[model samples]
Target: MSRPVVGYAPGAYDMFHIGHLRVLERARSECDLLIAGVATDAVVLSAKAKHPVIPFEQRLEIVSSIRYVDQAIADPHVDKYLTWQRIGFHVLFKGDDWRGTERAHEMESKLESVGVGIVYFPYTGDVSTTLLRTRLSVSE
Candidate 1:
C-alpha cells in the first residue's frame, strides 16, 4: 500500500481570520491528512512575548472547526523538528514570510536532515492576528 502523505502546519491561530484559513486549506490540499498545531498560550507568550486575544482553548476550538484541518493538536513547543518527530509528517508547511530568514534556513536544514520536505506558502496580504490586535488597540 502507498504511504499516506501527512502534513504538519503550526501556528497560534488567535483571532482567526482568512490568512489562517488560507494556510490550513493550502496545507490540506498537499497531503492526505493535515495536522494543524495550535500553539498554547504559554508557547505564544514565550515565543511572541504577547498573550493571545483569544484563549488557547478558543483557538483550538476554532482551528478544530476549520473544514480543512483534519486534526488539531496543542502545540507546547516551537521546535518544528520535534513536532515532526512526534507526528511523522512528510511535509512541513510554513508561511513564505518566514522564508529566507537565518532561523528558517536552519529549520529547513533540520527538517531536510530527517527527509522531510519544507513548503512555504505565500502569506496572505493585509491581515494577521498581530495586525488585528494593533488595529483594535488603535481604535480603543
Candidate 2:
C-alpha cells in the first residue's frame, strides 16, 4: 500500500479565521491527512510582540476540533524543517505569500533534501486573524 500524503501547517491559530480554514481545506485537498502545529505560548511571544488572545492549549483544542484537521500538535520551534523532521509529514503547506521569498527558498532547500515537498496555497485576501482582530478591537 502507498503511504498516505500528509501536509503540515504551523501557527499561533489564535481566534481561527476564514483564512486559516482556507489553508486547512487546501492542505486537505493536497494530502490524505492534515496536521496543524499550534505554536506554544513561549514560541508565540518570541515570534510576535502580541501574545495570542486564546491560550496555546485552547488554540490546540480549537484547531484539533476542526473537521479538516486530522491532528494538532504544539510547535515549540518555528522552523518548518525541524517540524517536518519531527512529524515526518510528506508536504509542508503554507500561504503563497511566502513563496519564492528568501524564507521559502531556504525552507524548500532544507525540506527537499529530506524528500519533503512544499505546497504554497493562494492566500485568502482580506480575511485573516489579524484583520479580524483589528475589526474586533475597533468595535469594542
Candidate 3:
C-alpha cells in the first residue's frame, strides 16, 4: 500500500462513450497513474465476432486523448493477469458487469494470489457502444 498505485482498465473502446470516460476517470482517481488498454481490431473481431465501427488506431488515439488516462496500449490478449504481469499494475479496474462471471472469478483468484487489488466500477450498460450501433444502423 505504500508504493504508488498504478491502475489499469482494459476495454474494446469501439465508440468511446461517456461510460468509458466514467470508468477511466474513476480509475484515475484511485491510482497515481492510469493506463487504458484498447482492444485491437483483430482481437475484438476474434472475441466478439464483429469489427468495431471505429478502427483500432482511431480508438487508441481517442482513449489516449482522454484526460484521465496516463498511457494507452493496444491489447491483443484477453488475459487480465497477463496484462498485469506485463504492466505491473497495482490495481485492476473493470466494469461491474463482469463482477460475478467466471472470468471475474478467475481474475479475482489470480490477483488475490499475488495480493493485487481488484475493483469494479458501476456498469453503464444502457450507454454502451452496442446500443449506439443498433440505433445508428436502424437510422441508416
Which stretches in model 3 have alpha-carbon errors above 4 Å? none
**True-vs-predicted CA distance for residue 111, candidate 3, Å:** 1.9
lDDT of 2 by residue, 1-140 (tens): 99898889877888888888888887888899899999999888886778889998899999999998999999998678888878899888888878888867988999999999888888887887778889999999
Off by over 4 Å in 2: none
Model 3's alpha-carbon lDDT is 0.90
lDDT of 3 at 15: 90
- Alpha-carbon error at 6 in model 2, in Å? 1.9
For each candidate, the alpha-carbon lDDT, in order, equals 0.92, 0.86, 0.90
The 10 consecutive residues of candidate 1 with the worst lDDT sum are 77-86
- Clash count, candidate 1: 0
Candidate 1's residue-wise lDDT over 36-94, tens digit each?
99999999999789998899999999999999999999999777888888889999898
Alpha carbon lDDT at 23, candidate 2: 89
Using lDDT, rank the candidates from best to worst: 1, 3, 2
Compared with the true structure, what per-residue lDDT tens digits does model 3 show for residues 1-140?
A: 58788888999999989999999999999999999989999889986789999999999999999999999998887777888888888898999988999978998999878888999999997899889999999999
User: Per-residue lDDT for 120 in model 2?
Assistant: 84
